[model samples]
Target: MKTLYIVRHAKSSWKYSGINDIDRPLKKRGIKDAHLMSKVLNKMVDKPDVFISSSANRALHTAVIFCENFGFPHFNLQIKRQLYSFSDGYLVKTVNALDDGFNSAIIFSHDHGINTFVNEFGNRPIAHVTTCGIIGLKFKEKHWKNIRRGETFLVEFPKNHK
Candidate 1:
């Protein structure tokens, strides 16, 4: 079995009006929530073998915080522009390209994309994947390429702790 974490990028800052959406950084609340979610994930299960995120600033920052808490090196995180898109098929392709040697992975992305990605691999209907939320899925397939729908094992949202 292989495990995957579908994470919504942490809350972003709207403080800078002229800043591009892709360039927007995490807000203070986002930073706090990232740490909180990381602590929660630390107790959930074995750490993911790899971390991946959209190259967008908010998503990448969120991934970095989570990877730090998970004790994963920065070099292990993969950044893909496709992850910023809401295309479910593209997200699947990204996951399919992973090395079979890695048993688990965490993918940080934006709202609609994160929501769509989780539903692809889960039995439940997740209306929204809130910022810093983590949805865990465990597939029966041995290889990432064969991963399909599986049991939704976990759902952790920042509000749940607040």
Candidate 2:
């Protein structure tokens, strides 16, 4: 069995002048929410073996907070450019290429793709995946290549708690 944790980057700040969308930093609320969600994840499951994130600054920052709070110091995170503004097909391909040695992995990226990826694999329609939202999926397959639609055993989001 394998597990995939899909997380959308925390809320980003548009308050900064002349900041590109890809370089936008997390808002104050985003930081707070990241910490909260990290705590929730620590209580729910063991730390993931791999952390993958989009190259975007917001996504990278969110992944950092999750790693710090979970005491997962090993930064084997890969910044996938394809994940920057890709569709669900690209996201799925990225996941399917993960190393089989990793029993669990975490992916931090943007919306739409994250939302669609989780919904497709989990066999459920997810509304907006708010900033800092998380969707945990348990798959029966050992390799990412074997993951298919309706193979997920769990799906969750941070908003569900509040």
Candidate 3:
């Protein structure tokens, strides 16, 4: 079985002047939320074997917090440039290209694309993925290449908690 954890980047700070969207940092509430989500993830029965994230600052920062709370080394993270503002197809391709050794993986990225990606492959009909939210999917296949649409067995988000 394969498990995919899709997480949207935490809320970003708009305090910086003329800052690029990719360079935006997380807001105070975002940081707190990320930590809370991380704690929740740490209690999961299936921990991710790999961490994949966009190179964007906010996404990368959110991934870092998850790594810290989950006791995973930062060096294990794989920053994929294509993850930044990529389409749902691109995101799915990226995921399907991941190493087969990874039975479980975590992907941290933005909205719209993230929402589309999950909705396309997962069992749920997700319209939006809020900041610091997580969507978990379990596939019956052993490899990413075998993953297909409507194969998800589970779905979850931080917002669903409270």
Which numbered prediction scores highest in lDDT against the true structure? 1
Off by over 4 Å in 1: none
Task: Score every model by TM-score.
Answer: 0.95, 0.91, 0.92
Best TM-score among the predictions, by candidate number:
1
- Per-residue CA lDDT of candidate 1, range 59-116, in tens? 9999999989989899978999988786677678888898899898888887776677
Counting clashing residue pairs in each candidate, in order, gives 0, 0, 0
RMSD of each: 1.1, 1.7, 1.6
Candidate 2 segments exceeding 4 Å error? 151-155, 160-162
lDDT scores in order: 0.88, 0.84, 0.85
In candidate 2, what are the lDDT values of residues 1-162, reduced to their tens digit?
Answer: 888889898888998998787899999988888988888888988989898889899999998999889887745667787888757877898899999999999999888898788878886677777889888888888788998764555555667665
TM-score leaderboard ranking: 1, 3, 2
Q: Looking at model 3, report the run of 10 residues with the lowest lDDT sum.
A: 150-159
lDDT of each residue in 58-151, candidate 3, tens digit only: 9999999999999889998999988998577667877899899988899998888888888888877877788988888888887898798645
So what's the TM-score on candidate 2? Answer: 0.91
lDDT of 1 at 3: 88
Clashing pairs for model 3 are: none
Candidate 1, residue 142: Cα displacement in angstroms equals 1.3
